[model samples]
Target: MGIDGGIGRLPLAVADAVRTGGGEIRTGAPVRELRRTADGWTVVTDGEVLRADAVVVAAPAPAAARLLAADSPAASAELATVDYASMALITMAFRRDDVASLADGSGFLVPPVDGRTIKAATFSSRKWGWLRDAAPDLFVLRTSIGRFEDEEHLKRDDADLVGMSLADLGAATGLDARPVATRVSRWDGGLPQYPVGHLERVARIRAEVAKLPGLRVCGAVYDGVGIPACIGSARTAADELLTATLAAGAVGGERE
Candidate 1:
């Protein structure tokens, strides 16, 4: 698939499309609760209460669990058991001339056994054509730190992390280059960890949620963690909700 500008641009485009389609988009408005009502469903957020025929709790497992605790206690409990991993990305940009020997490929992965702070590094300039064209004189690379239960490394200051990343990069690629610009992005509990019994747990959660009408849950907690997987899960949830709503309407019309 073609990446437009950067990975972040895709979400912005999606949001723009939704707006263009006359759909309301709210950012940073945390939903406080989901209440089932006689007419439909009530979504209580920090600012307002939105009434909808169906509600999809597309938050991370822990947040979703909190919202569903009152409606589907069983599902909430199961979702609460889902584990996650935290990681940080250190993006460094160096003057092309400062680096003696840049790697030929799109960076490399440092195995856990290698005893390095960075788990993986990506050569953003080489991997993405947009970035290369945007800054031809700069070499952009990003290094990831932290893994499951490996939170200690993230405590370091941004400068320290940058140093660590550069040291590791130098050792791996023999490029003792000084970065011209740096950025540190930390994602706490970003990636969900799918353990041995994760699928079973998800099945149980879904089954329990299915019992609650007008309520559905989807996100990194239930399906694959990648963007494509999350999108697929969302589509499935939306389709299920639409189908159920139509079936209920048909039954009500027949009774009328």
Candidate 2:
């Protein structure tokens, strides 16, 4: 259940496994378009064009729509309608002696009604044993900001965001310590917003895309947004693609 190093190590492990299974992993290659060829698919990127029997479009809804718009208009339109939200994370490191006593738990979430800039905060060093052991004298913490239909705070400067987070931290936990280091990570249109007819829209998209051979789409836009949900959707898409491919081959063999 636990990764050896951290969650960041998962991509490398997955890439290694793919290589072992004779699949290539290309990093930093921006795909330009996906074209349906006579027999399979042609993935056109900035640098090269790769052909494959099956194609899984696992990008965000908008990006996937662009890729499939030419071929699958209905699915692309549905994907285009999927909404997204932006968020930012401000991580700060403070000298343990300078901060006030923290609560026993790892962190806390601020309700929207509180009218605070920070939505939530996590005591990284306290929550993760590995981080605490690595830097015992430093208190590493991060605050999340912005949410669906509320992204005006994200327009502020990084320093201002950090200051707001610190102010909220002070009010919430009575911690009035100045951080020695700070890092701000911004994600634009990061999380998808699932409105009321989301599942039906996803079903329609899947049905439309399934009409085309060797094409499949799956991601947070269609299902749950968590990592586990994304993985499950990917697995299901892969299974369906493989099953259809095998069944077609069997029918062809019988005809021959």
Candidate 3:
């Protein structure tokens, strides 16, 4: 199969497929605390407290820092250093007639050289199959803003963000349509930047966390930020947890 056919809208589509396979999703419940116990570990949530052989904290670096602060101060201290950028994505849907010179394909990535208020625009519908089928008469333009370099732009209001996106879109695709629907998503601390010596820092953090039995961490801040990388890290963390549990059991058996 061609690349696009094989990987098109894979994440969302796969999630939907899993739902068809009887997967359940939970919302509104947030974990409160995690404490290590003699037997294993305890997960404290708003409604319940549960026990598990191990834990893998997959939250962002700052949140992870707060979570690990009391128990794993060392790990928390290290995680606090992992920084993220604030960003906003504005998704605007426009009628084709209102937009001119826009192409139906992957979106354009803006290099810093563009020197524009908005970052990049993704032609969402054309790039993915499921989205394409939803609104045949409409075009979805996803524009990004705010980066480490452009920190000031993040303070802009919704009107400013929309204006910047529209300006860039107009310049790029000659699209001057007032969007039928506009959605803005603001990520407080966006994707983590793997700066120089990031690998070394992560290695040290992993080594420290390893010393804490029944404790593990897996997230975009740890291995990678991409979906595949996050999934891979979780899988690896699960395997590690299983190995540790088996080894502990063996020691207990010998003691008995």
Query: CA lDDT of each candidate?
Result: 0.86, 0.88, 0.79
Report the error of model 1 at residue 60, Å: 0.6
Q: Which residue runs of candidate 2 sit more than 4 Å off their true CA positions?
A: 1-4, 250-256
Q: After superposition, how far is residue 16 of candidate 1 from its true place, in Å?
A: 1.5
Count of backbone collisions in candidate 2: 0
- Model 2 Cα displacement at 253 (Å)? 19
Candidate with the greatest TM-score versus the true structure: 1
Ranking by TM-score: 1, 2, 3
Give lDDT tens digits, candidate 2, residues 53-93: 78899999989999999889999999999999999999999
Task: Highest lDDT: give the candidate number.
Answer: 2
Off-target runs (Cα >4 Å) in candidate 1 are 250-256
Superior by lDDT: candidate 1 or candidate 3: 1
Report the error of model 2 at residue 84, Å: 0.8
Can you rank all candidates by lDDT, best first? 2, 1, 3
User: What digit string (tens of lDDT, one per residue) describes model 3 on residues 1-256?
Assistant: 2234335468668678779998543457677787777776777778878776777887888878887887888888989998788899999898867765676567888888878877788877677766657777887779999887577888888878998899887888777779998988898787898999998988988888888887788989877888778988988887998898897783321111
The lDDT, on a scale of 0 to 1, for candidate 2 is 0.88
Residue 122 lDDT in candidate 1: 93
| Tens-place lDDT digits, model 1, residues 1-256 | 5585888888899999999998778899999988777756778887787778888889998899899888789999998888899999999999977764786899899888899989999998889889989999998999999999877989888999999998898888898878989999999999999999998998899899888776678877878998988998888888998899898883321100
